[model samples]
Target: MNKLKLSGILAVIALFAMASCTQKKESNSPKNLQIDNKILAQNLAQKFIITDGHIDLPYHLKSMGFLDLKNTPTLVDGIKGDFDFPRAKKGGLDAPFMSIFIPPALQKTGGSKELADSLINMVEHITTSFPNHFGLASSPNDVIKNFKSGKISLPMGMENGSPIEGDINNVKYFFDRGIRYITLTHGKVNEICDSSYDPVRTWNGLSPFGKEVVLEMNKQGIMVDVSHISDSTFYQVMELTDVPCIASHSSVRKFTPGFERNMSDDMIKLLAKKNGVIQINFGSSFLTYKYEKRLKERDSLKRIFMKENNLTGKDSLAKAFNTKWLEENKLYADVEIVADHIDHVVKLTGIDHVGLGSDYDGVGNSLPTGLKDVSGYPNLLEELLNRGYSEEDIEKICYKNVFRVWNAVLDHAGKNN
Candidate 1:
């Protein structure tokens, strides 16, 4: 009786263990989810608002010496640029913040404000020219309406606060002109704040005037972009800002160590605490240190070759050599690398604090492979989906998080006014 009873008990325990193991394995298995991630990604892209925090459409147009977007041949069809009407439509991109970039050179010399105004005008003209295909989005509600109408929304974000000059009132002025966010500085320290790229940490953070600009931005319902600012500037802005700030197009600094342009782990955590969002940049240099090193090496070699050949930039020899160099040194981190940045943010914080801000049209030729242009968004969405992200999380990444910060800024401004 003892041997029979013991054997029966052992068999039952073994059966229970097998069932538990199977359940545990299936829970962790991506394949067991029985979902076609590709289709899910595509569907989610189409169904959601897909608001990228920054896109350099206005700057791209300005570079062409053409203020026109609809009549611009390159935008009508895909050119060497990373964003265009056709590509955005194909990618299901509904809302993209058209970056009004003011070159830092214009800061000391002045004219930044005028240039910013002109770029904003160009964006408005694009909407007027292609009314059926494009519309201006001044708020989150406008984006939703544009989405309903099957039109792409072109919201504006100024890439440099140089446009504001030293005038605190100009912050509200730009916001009135539909400039929703302002990157306080660019490659150089300005009157507003110290830049990450500049060696001179003039103010050590935000200048006295910069703090005024931040307050005005908050009062006027404009997001304070911290992508190009110094770590001190970021920290100071974080402390001073009443509303959530955004690194409109930055990657995880953990992936690219010492890259001040990317947010650090602690910065990300602090940002999440403030209910802010970090939109992942898809540039190869921003994604991984290894890729960034390769890019630097390639540039160094290219410069050496140019010098050795005595080829000036305008010469045919220089052009040919530059072409050859680009072709040979075109190193792209895959779309997975970009997805990894998104995953890193989500892991550190929650999915609520992360979103897409590809820096498209702004990254030059360093865009990650399979994410070459606006049309490449589905590739990223698919990667996130396959990595076990649900549609809800993807939607948040696409637009909800962006809207949350945007609305918060607006709401904060409303209360102050």
Candidate 2:
């Protein structure tokens, strides 16, 4: 019984070991790990209250002529923009700061305040029109309350300070009207500050009135947004403001070199030092220089094509040509690059300073591959989990970091008042 029985026992042991090894390998395989991470990411997205620093739904609605109460139902899913009730719910977007965007042209057109008021009114109308689906949030507490009640919070952040209309009192007025943060300027210098996109650099920084506006904003408990302001304006505002400021929809300039619209590495660090968050934008151009370079080339070619064909951009032929070119070129950045921007911020500052601020609707058709709409947030969170981000870190990136700044602004205002 000795040799035969021993060989049989050894074979059984070997078979058991092989089975265990195979099971372990299957569990740890890349495909299984990705699926596990995807599930975890989706759970984290819904478990935590996700607050996107900026979403251009209000402006997008106005442009589409769907800002009226009669057309409000379209926002449930009938519209074409990146944000809608169904998509926001699917993505677990609890609080998305609705951009009350006042185009710079309005600053000269003598109707900045009116346009801002109208946009704010439209947001209010949305909340009223769909009470169960939306609520207006003026503070972090409001967001929390809305989240608990299963309502999406529509906080307001003015894209340009043009609505202040040269009146210091309008700062308080806007705060009362639920403008939580205000980007000093956009695409051009305004009475408040110089825009990064403006070549003129009108004030070289904040105007004398701009400094007053910043202080007024602080006193009113409004977070000053430095997203589109010039570098000089940023530095000056940082020196003047008492509370932490946010770059609501800006990404890191390190990724897209020479794009002042995105914050620099040094700027991110400073923002972190003040306990502020830089919500990373998901636009392809904001994620990498390649996209910007390709965009420039595409624009140049389009101009040449238009000229050669004697067609305007609005012409159907030119539109078709542009669409076809984009389809063939396919230069969009993927979700991984967006995670890279978040990683860059986490490395330069910390996880507390980075948050999501997908410029939906505002970025046109240049959103990154997996982040093409509000519903794609889970994809980014899955990437973050795969890259070794913990649930706590994801929560901070999702909402807590921004809430800290918002609460601080409120506390400062309370003490001064």
Candidate 3:
């Protein structure tokens, strides 16, 4: 009860209050908060097993004539493509469905099946050449096993169904070869279905044989990818498929209006209703209309310049002019635009029906600014975090959504068998 003791106790309490206030100020500082988010984003990127629905690495290599095992090391170290072993690891991409993109021309030239086989063989060769870094994944369980062993899973998806070669049995053949999904058509109408880009509408939808192909796919447990198919074809497949399907790398048409290559609002809604997922494509043209408009303007200007200078497209002068123009007028969507596509999907359908299907090497150089390669996934994760997405939401968007559809397809096939 002494005056000196009371004064001493009051001073100690004031010091404790001051220290607590200082701690609160530092923790809430903008810079400190930003740093915390960045760290959290990076940690999440590594914590979850990221699975991209589509990546065109197999065809990219075939086009470059680098399918031989001698060039296998480039897949781990080369910077020529958006996906490589090192970049995928940095981005936390555990399973990227390697697109076995068979061109439509091969359907008429009489070598579609052979070409598909060759590409599949090349993928097999890569895994054989570098067993420590890459593993062939035939199922979701395989992907998880590869991830646990610190290896990237190379699951395959055929970009065009041309490789089916008009034989219903070919569907099972591809499934046996590790082809999990088959995009019915690409750039042109084929026996199975019409393409979004082909105005001919040859069959007006799925051909008579195409219906059989769909049922065969369902029986064989292969996903039917509706990416480049015509609207009629898409509807037909949706009706025919018994199991949930996926649009492996298509964006919503809300941004690019009238671009049939992207799915419409109605299509997305129907897809979600059927328990399917539409993986968002990260290409700038797919994300926004601005990219296409700018691209057209640049091309028009380049054509005028070449005509004025009497330079052909093959001429070095024309090429130089095009490059310079593009540099000055960069036509690209940023990471935020990509997130907008994701947001639109989440709002239209719940978060369960949307996932990442960045058409990495397939999109050429038109990827969003910060997401230029496979290593930019953390940038995307950070954007989602900033938008108030919970960790559980991020996990579903990362892989669980697609895996649910995948496992459903497998289960359907098993039950039928």
Q: Estimate each model's TM-score.
A: 0.86, 0.92, 0.92
Superposed Cα deviation of residue 83, candidate 2 (Å)? 0.9
Clashes per candidate, residues 3 or more apart or on different chains? 0, 0, 0
| Candidate 3 residue-wise lDDT, 1-417, digit = tens | 999999999999999999999999999787886777788888998889899989988888877877664665457775588999898888899999999998888888878898889889999998998899999998899988998999999999999998888888899999999999999899999998899999998899999999999898899999989999999988888888898899999998999988999999999999998899999999999999999899899889988898899999899999898778878986999989889989999999989999999999998989999999999999999889888898999999999999999999988999987
> Which candidate's TM-score is highest?
2
Per-residue C-alpha lDDT of model 2 across residues 1-417, encoded as one tens digit per residue: 799999999999999999999999999899999999999999988999999988998888888776564656467754787988888888889999999998999888889999899899999998987899899998888999999999999999999999899999999999999999999999999999899999998899999999999999899999999999999999998899899989999998988889999999998999888888999898888889999789889899999999999998789999998789989996899999999999999999878888988989899989988888888899999999999999999999999999999999999999998
| lDDT of each candidate versus the true structure | 0.88, 0.91, 0.90
- TM-score of candidate 2 relative to the true fold: 0.92
Runs of candidate 2 with Cα error greater than 4 angstroms are 1-18, 67-70, 299-324
Identify the superior model by lDDT, candidate 2 or candidate 3.
Answer: 2
Candidate 1 root-mean-square deviation in Å: 5.0
Query: For model 1, what is the alpha-carbon lDDT of residue 56?
Result: 87
Candidate 3, residue 238: CA error in Å? 1.8
Model 3 scores worst on lDDT over the 10 consecutive residues at 66-75
Regions of model 3 farther than 4 Å from truth: 1-26, 68-73, 304-330
Q: Which lDDT tens digits does candidate 1 get at residues 1-417?
A: 699999999999999999999999887577744356767777877888898888987777778767644455445556668888788887889999999999999987889999998899998887887788889999999999999999999999999999888888888899889999999999999999999999999999999999999998999999999999999999999999999988899889998889898999999999999999999888888998888677678778767887998877788876787677668765778998988888889999999999888889898888888988998888888898778788889889999998999999999999999
Descending-lDDT candidate ranking: 2, 3, 1
Ranked candidates (TM-score, high to low): 2, 3, 1
